[model samples]
Target: MSMHMEQTVQPPVDHSVSYPKFLWRALRAATDGGPLFYGSMTILTIVALLGANAWAKQVVHGMAVTDMTDHVSWGLYVANFTFLVGLAAGGVMMVIPAYLYRDDDMHDVVIVGELLAVAAIIMAMLSIVVDMGRPDRLWHLIPGIGRMHWPISMLTWDVIVLNGYLLLNLHVCGYLIYTRWLGRTPNPSWYVPFVFMSIFWAFSIHTVTAFLYCGLGGRPFWNSALLAPRFLASAFVTGPAFIVITLKALRARSAFQIPEGAIERLLSIVRITALINLFMAASEVFVEFYTGGSHTASARYLYFGLHGHEELVPWIWTALGLNAAAAVVLLSKPLYRRPGVLVAALVMTFVGVWIEKGMGLIVPAFIPSTLHEIVPYVPSATEWIVTAGIWAFGMMIYIVALKIGLQAMSGRLVRSDLPPAVGAVPQEAE
Candidate 1:
């Protein structure tokens, strides 16, 4: 007999699972963490709960509970909102290198940046909601349900861009993670276009936020043409600085070895952007002091006391000091190379940007009210609590998302029905 008999062909493995199953697996991965993870989550949850209680009290009582007054209407919440918007926008820095430049190392961790954007945007939205006092009125911003006043109101534009950017990031991250969980290669056509669009969208969110402030002719301090550029520059600095710290943490704590090259690239970005941010700030200061007009009142009050009032004087100086110190350390190759020094520099950069964008920028604008009367605004304890809570909540979201992402990227969170993916492992940097 011709032994060429019947050849039995093995069928290709399906390796596919239901979307619900994929989600379940992702949840399991996110929940599976060490003691440190659990402890951190618990602390964040406690803080978030405290914040929620504070907000509940605020809702029951009114905006009067906070320190806000008619003269200084916008306070801590709006300030946080402004800073977080820039932070969200900053995520595009990672995406630019990963997708646009085709950087493999960056590509591997770009999802972290995108996920950070999602968390930041969520916090930013919460900041706005809390600032509104009557959170229920948020429905008014909806286009169909309420009057969005599109094309007319910069606030409407802001709502659109922020929500759009949030959705874009969510889609990109969700699609990538879900597809990977299924042990399938993500289709470039599905997410590539959105990733590129997000770059421009990120810019728009911050630019529009800047416009929202600068568009106010009444607020001379915010009416600067340079505000948008300054926002972008500072965003780049804070965004990459944050990523560097996160990458370092991942390398230290997690199985996923984040590439040193990626951290170096981010450090380089921070060095350049930090310098640019400082230059822009200096330019603004020079222009404000040189002009010596009524508009300079806010700037003067911010940098130096505009009379007997010097509440913000200390705040602005501290922010400047921090920014200056961070830039110095980041620029110093010796310091930047040391892991501890790099993290400290990045933290300083983040905090410095926060103060610069928050208290330094927002409060000063309203220091001398429209009637030219000096009225200083300070955040109340409730405001502080709520702010802390929002931050904690954001951290919680970020940590969970990061866990899911890392697990998926490592090929550890694949379809349960299939064996561990063969040759599907990503080449992580050594």
Candidate 2:
């Protein structure tokens, strides 16, 4: 008898089973029919659709309908886009824990984080496209067509690197998850390149963003060498904060339980990162003030106040205090060990970082403006609506990706009969 036939046969399976049954079960679990998920989704959908309509109207009627004047060309949408991009890359920082330490608990969540990265990048691209005066002519940036501005510009390089990194993330993430669904192993050779590229890309996105403002030389506040490091510190804290919050929400909503051990471990990791972030901010304060140059003046304008523009100063101080307090709380063994304290720490860290990195970063760059004039640009209603849509879209993308990933991992909806595969592989066949 053939070896295959000679093998002890397993119980006969019914090949006639309905595939829809499997698919429906997976879909239901992912959607969960919860008010929070669906309600948020509905609100976002309406907002996004309205934003899209408004954009179309702007395109047809010209940019006059919106509040973007010459003084503040880049409004709320652009600022939010910048923030979200950094947040998207937040997950990339965790690769150190997973690969370097071989922490298996982080493995399952890593891809989910990567998916968030992908969504954030897409949102950035969308925001940029929308902000363009001549989005139709955007294609001219290509080599064969228009002036491919290079060598003279970091943005040219940024364009190349950001898109390449996005593709690499998608490929690496898609291959790994798809293969898992197919019950197969990834081709390590292919994935290794992506893994290394992803690490570099993570650093590149934030570095490029900092350079975009700093390299101008005119913007003294942004010109500091410490800018890149600060960007990294902020990203490290904010990204992890977002993940912790999301994971907690997931555990609460889903049947899958987050182990007390896992929660504590993640809390400790976030606390350490948060402390590092606070340390960097404090060091920046010392260096900027101690140096006592044009840059220091600008920094003071941001931290203390500059003329009437001091509107953000008190809020900024509040953010700084909150960040430090949260970091201390997390660093404590007893607090970090507790789920409630951990959650609170993460919440504070996330909010504080959002304020610090979002407003603190952007506002500081402009204050004591390169031109030495304080041009306060408040966001318009249109801008707020658009920002809401963008945020919703990001959450929606994350929700969808997480649901799909969980289903594949749990052997629901389009799952393979074989054991779960870990890393990169093909997408289609079982």
Candidate 3:
């Protein structure tokens, strides 16, 4: 004899009826809730406040407070901004698996990445603000009201895509999560097409960011055809790894269960992406060193020492070492199975990509200036404080959003009155 079982599925749920209530409930759930949740938010808020204060100092004191110069104009702020944009785009990787691939577990857990994308986009914009000496003049970017530079400029296109992507994600996530909070399945027509668009928009964000950097003929290090590919590869690695770690944490803390095959699938994605990323890095390196020219100066400074300035050498190598270590661990099925090893590998992958993308990619490009001046750049105290604050602020957003996600997943915050279970009944009568 054989037996089959199934979950009670809701039939054609109309979620709008309870949606207005979900907003208040989710907001309340964010607050009048758990100790640990609020505790983390408190710490992140303080950090954000501290960062805001530091930015105020920059506004008053001037750009002299930072180590940036005409030669190396963009520093920690832009680097972080660039990195966060990649992080935001990477969120779509999760959505692809969940929606396109029809992975049921990933579909349920999709909100985690959506929350991450929102937080990251917010931080990326914040980074842009803090990096500018004239943040008050930001409205100039507005189409009709401000600077109005678009169609002709890469930066303008970048601004459009980044903001558009952010808003698109916000809508999709808000609609889906709100429906979930109302204890109803979302209308497929509402979010399904948007989900597909997000996948393409995600690629655009990273590709545009790479073009922004690589378009600079003045900086040969970033002026490579490989930049966009590398950006996508690294994003694939870090984004899925982040989701995996978050899933594990969620599994441990809440009643929300991550499906059995999810982690394994994520690990496989990381393995493949990491391999491509490393390959691209090696290819770029070989070309840079083998065909030596003024074009290779920035690469030289990054890999070895340029003249006497070897500052970035150690940082780049450290990033490389961590990436290699992470790839090795991830590639091994036996080691990847261990929880401790898995966590450590994911951390290594994220940290490695952070350094590689931020410091390694940005700082070195400006070292050997067009005038052949070697300017060794290091972040200022104000830069560090502000950078730390941006991350803290983003973390706060992610944590709160993730908390609400857990509630929705565990069916604690909202109880869906699903239809009763139905199955074929055994019959003896004809």
**What is the per-residue lDDT of model 3 for residues 1-75, given as tens digits with 9 covering 90 to 100?**
000113247565454656666777787766754566667778889999999999899999998899999999898
Best by lDDT: 1
Model 1 C-alpha lDDT per residue in residues 1-430, reported as the tens digit of each score:
0112244453444445467787887888788777788899999999999999999999999989889999999999999999999989988989988877777788778888999999999999999988886787888888789988999989889999999999999999998888677766666778888988999999999999999999899999999999999999999988888888888888877778677777778888888999999999999999999989888999989988988899988888888898999999977888777858878988988998999999999999998998999988889999999999999999999999998887776676787766776544443221
Model 3 clashing residue pairs (backbone): 140-147
Using lDDT, rank the candidates from best to worst.
1, 3, 2
Q: Count the backbone clashes (under 3 Å) in each candidate.
A: 0, 1, 1
lDDT of 2 by residue, 1-430 (tens): 0101233334443434634544454465457655766787788788878777766666777766656555445555666666766776677755655555666677556665687788888787777766677778888888678887886787777677778878988887766655444443445665766877788888888888777767877677667788777777777777877777777877777754344444455666676778788888888888889989766766887788767667668768878888988988877778767867777877787778877877677766665556677776556666666666666676677777777665565434344455444332222111
For all predictions, the C-alpha RMSD in Å is 5.8, 6.4, 6.4
lDDT by candidate, in order shown: 0.87, 0.68, 0.82
Clashing pairs in 1: none
- Worst 10-residue lDDT window for candidate 3 reads 421-430
Give residue 121's error in model 1 in angstroms.
0.5
